[model samples]
Target: MTHDEIWRALDALAAENGLSASGLARKAGLDATAFNPSKRIGADGRARWPSTESLAKVLTATSTGMADFAALVTGMAAALPRGSRGPAARRIPLIGLAQAGGEGYFDDGGYPVGGSWDEISVPEVGDPNAYALEISGESMEPVFRDGDIVIVSPGAPIRRGDRVVVRTEKGEVMAKELKRQSARRIDLRSLNPAHPDYAFDLTEITWMHRIVWGSQ
Candidate 1:
């Protein structure tokens, strides 16, 4: 990919992930400005090449494999058809609690039996890895209310302060902001004061992922 293309992609990714290039670099354990736009342009005004080490650090920071990184660099960032941009227009089949008992988590056939689904519209997020979920309760309000549609990007990494959807081994699904994570437990801050803040044992978690964009 050209330097401009890489710079643009990195800029978009940084914005979507709520991070600056320097912040992303820090997260990736690299020197600040490793992926800065300024650094992408040489002193002679030519395109500067990205170092392999810098790319490796970024991949690790984003928890993305080389192949996935390659796909983004190739301008095939998992996007859907143009007309399917709205949340109400693109929905994935999600089996609810009533149907979840015998269903597997996701790949094991435990979630839902079919692809029947609804549609939601979320703006500015073009990744096809993004999908929508309807808020079922008022646990997260002001920011997210009951019936609000949330677009989730399973490809996004969990980060401090990011709103997330968490599934417990007991078959409970909840939404909250991530405060911290460790090998043993996760701390969650409730968006609604009426609901108690969550401190879940990590071992009991079935899955935890971020909400990329949401529309009320």
Candidate 2:
């Protein structure tokens, strides 16, 4: 690709991802000014070309694959939209479970709301993907505790041995490591054995799925 095209792609990608040139450079583990507009201007006032090494550094730091980078450099307009998915995931304010029943902590319907909640960002689960709930009790302690934001990705196929957040129809929400699942039942090990091992029938579970990630 032409040097101008490469530089422009870098600039556009950085902006779309909410990064400054320096920020994108640092994210990719390169010299802060590696893709700066000034760096592209030569002593003779012509634009300098981005070297292969610099391009490789940018690719590595952003975890962008080569074919995608090539598509970006080639002036394909589609690359712009793909960058939106890079870091813009769904996140919402989280409220501790203990405080959930307190004044102005959540809506009357139990949806989280108000000034007491802290914003917790997480990856968006596309297509019937579910939401998140903050952990509140010590019943599932050591692995998950009060105030932890648990990102639940329901509708994503669950595999055996994945750690999950399970909500029972009886209104108990708990985190457990999955051991096995059958059409009629789910076998799980509690994070806190003080609670005992769980083996619930599918009818008893209101919702059950993996915890993709979490934050303290």
* Residue-by-residue lDDT tens digits, candidate 1, 1-216: 466556655654565468898888888898887887778878999998777887777777777665545535433343332223344344454333223333443543122234444444434445544556677667787678866766655666565676787777887777788988988999999988888998989878877767655555
- For candidate 2, give the lDDT of residue 157: 46
User: Which regions of candidate 1 fall more than 4 Å away from where they truly are?
Assistant: 1-91, 94-105, 108-113, 119-129
- State which candidate has the highest lDDT: 2
Query: If scored against the real structure, what TM-score would every candidate get?
Result: 0.53, 0.47
Stretches of model 2 off by over 4 angstroms after superposition:
1-89, 93-119, 123-129
By TM-score, the best candidate is 1
Cα-based lDDT for every prediction: 0.63, 0.65
Candidate 1, poorest ten consecutive residues by summed lDDT:
76-85
